[model samples]
Target: MTQFTPDLASRFARIALGHVERRYPFKLDQVLLGPDDRRSPTELHPVFHGSFDWHSCVHGYWLLARIGRRFPDLPEAAEITALFDRKLTPELVAGERAYLDRPLSGGFERPYGWAWLLKLAAELEQRMAPAERAWAEALAPLAQAFADRFRAYLPKATYPVRAGVHSNTAFALRLALDYAEAVKDQDLAALFRHKALAWYGADADCQAWEPGGDDFLSPALIEAALMARALPAGAFVPWLDRFLPRLAAQEPGALFAPATVSDRTDGKIAHLDGVNLSRAWCLREVAAALPVGDARRGVLGKAAETHLAASLPHVASDYMGEHWLASFAALALETA
Candidate 1:
């Protein structure tokens, strides 16, 4: 199986630190109410104005925190720490919080960015050095803002978003659950579990017609992984049985195969590489959640290996992919 080595961690850290503050080549997730709102990314976002977009930058910070905790002697640790100290200030966080309060910014990054901010906060909370803890404290209000968004939006969401992209409800919930469990937020955790069951509890026989050419996440597998996290072992096993009855047979052949990336230069096409890495992670999580003697364990395990092999090499090959793919690669190799 692929492992996260110190070398790999250093490499990914360098990639994130290289572009976390690059202002150009950015896609702002904001609404321009007037000429006054035409400010640059750094001025508007204050802290997260890099890695192409808001959510990716948030998770890029998450990758840095995760790797920094695991490999403290990393070459980029000082730089990462310095960046956090400079950027993750109370003033900057207040600016970010204010952005969320804007009338037109209600849907800004919504569940996707919201989830990543909480995940970053969770990482910082778990691995609290004196300096890092200060940064984490500074970021709490922004994290709470997103948490409030989740509490407000989920109940009103009549139908879950089943897309294989950033808007996917399962993907957001999985990450949010990680944050909730990390912080011992029982109310948030219970809310996520309830909503997940309501949205996907009855889902079965997923056709797995996915990889929409510009896709990243595996809708069926991510939902399965989320259910695996939310449900107990006994309940999960039965749920998995009903949801993916043909896993042993690999009926959804697409799930086993790696997506083909014809162009890495194009942003949307580059998403296929993300598909492979994310699918690898979801499959690994699902396989690990299964009973030891389950027949589908071997199937999911092999498919996870296949997908990892397909995308691990291309994580830092191009700017288009490099700006964000390392985070997904890290997620694929991360242990639960």
Candidate 2:
């Protein structure tokens, strides 16, 4: 296997260092931290403020995990670690907690938070500092609580999910894998594995389930591959290979030419419209995890370049501020 070139590695290192140093322990208690705090749902071009939402937080967790992996001297690493710990505080979410419901678009809030927190906690332990074992341990209960509540909540749940909502559930499966691996709970992890597989198998009518329509389906498949790897199953490999390239090939200039929507650069892409930075980053993430090879690296490079060229310039003043754009820029730079 070829080693990662110094240029690419250095770029990754810089982004990781930048992310840990720049991002922070701003606000964890408030469910919705408003756009000013670097968190938001709908982003308006040239405005770029932060708001609190499940998608943004999950994206944060995703970037932080990667940063912790590449950068050794990350300043905000500890603060991020603590922020995750704070998320587990049962004291804040005192009332009834719901699970499994597609709460991303507003059904319930706890599950999405737990999935992301658990994922960030696990990544912190694995790549940040092994010495922070105790800190990571503190968040396990929160993950377990989330899973329990989710199981309790999904008794009569619906399926065939849309892009935004289903992706959150897919994230929950990934978090379940993380929690299971970190806590060494094989049985619990297996249950998550089973659930994810079952969900994927849902009929064509299932909105949450994708039978290879590409775009969003590719990222979801990559995530499922991650879960499968953690749980050790061979089934996910083929689908992953099938979807990665399709997702990677989509470019920007082609879109503004053949478009139904009037202005593609408006920057308020939530669901539909076939293009969003979130889905593109998912491919970047999966490529990062895979063994470094010329083919794989090329795929990542293309994904990074496409996204960076189209999205990076918009980051500084966009409505969602620089958070998501910066995070994805870092990922793209890493692959480049």
Candidate 3:
């Protein structure tokens, strides 16, 4: 399994810091109202206005926070600290909160960015540094706002989004659960458990018809990972058997192979690299959750390595991929 080393940490940190505030080449997720609402990305999303889009920028910060915590002596640590100190302020957080108040803002980044914000807060909380803690404190309101969104939305989310894209519910719920567990939020954790069971408990025989052109997530694998976290080991094994019945044979060929990216410069096509990285992490997580002697464990582990090898080198291949891919790469390597 690939590990996150100081050199890799510096590489990812530099990528994140380089774009967190770049402010250009951005795609804003907003509901414009007249000319006044047609504003620049920074004007609309004060804190998350870089890395091509809101969710990317949000996770970019998450990557920096996570890497800085793990490798405190890295050269990028000081800059990461300074960046958080400057950006994660009460005023900026308030500004970010206010944006959610706008019309049609409920769907802005929806569960994806919302999940990353909570993940960022959880990372800072885990680090337990006074300065980092202060940054997390300042970002608490924003995190709470997202948590409230999840609480309000999940009850009404009658169907789970199985897309291999940003709207995927399993991916968001998994990240949110991490934050909930880290903060010891019993209410939030209960909500996640309820929703996970409600959404996926009856699921079986995943087709794994995935790797959509622009997909950066494996809907099948993400759901499996969520079940791994949400269910007890004994229950999870049965669930996994029902959901991926042929995993022992690796019958779903898509699950074991790495996705190919035809164009790294094309934003949508570039997502294949992310797909590989995220699939790597999800596969590794699923493997870890299985019984030690399970035959599927070895298959999943090898598939993870294959996927990691396919995408790890392309993380910084182009500006389009570089702006966001490092974070997913870090996720894959660190989780392994």
61 in model 3: Cα distance from truth in Å? Answer: 0.5
- Candidate 2, residues 1-336, lDDT tens digits: the string is 112344433443334333332323223233343556343222210110122344344555556555555653556556555644544244432221222222342334444555655565566557445545554454455455666655664444555233444345665665557766776777767767666655654322112233222232233533533444543445444544443334334322332121122343443432212333443444555555565563654655455445444544444443334334444445334433
The regions of model 3 sitting more than 4 angstroms off are none
Q: On lDDT, who's better, 2 or 3? A: 3
lDDT of 3 at 129: 60
**Candidate 3 local accuracy as lDDT?**
0.90
Give per-residue CA lDDT, model 1, range 1-336, as digits (tens).
888999999999999998888777999887788889889888889999998888889999999989888999988988888898899999999999999888799999977888889999999888656877898899999988899999999999999998989899999999999889888999999999999999999998888998888888889889998999998658998888889889899978888889999999888999999999999999989988988998888888889889989988999878889889999999889943
- For each candidate in the order shown, give its overall lDDT on alpha carbons: 0.90, 0.44, 0.90
Which residue pairs come into collision in candidate 1? none
lDDT of 3 by residue, 1-336 (tens): 688889989988988899889888888777778788887777777788888888889899999988888899999888988898889999888999999999888887888999998998888788676766888888899999999999999999999999999999999999999899988998999999899999999999989998898999999999999999988658999999899999989868998889999999998999999999999999998999988899989999999999999999998899899999998888878877
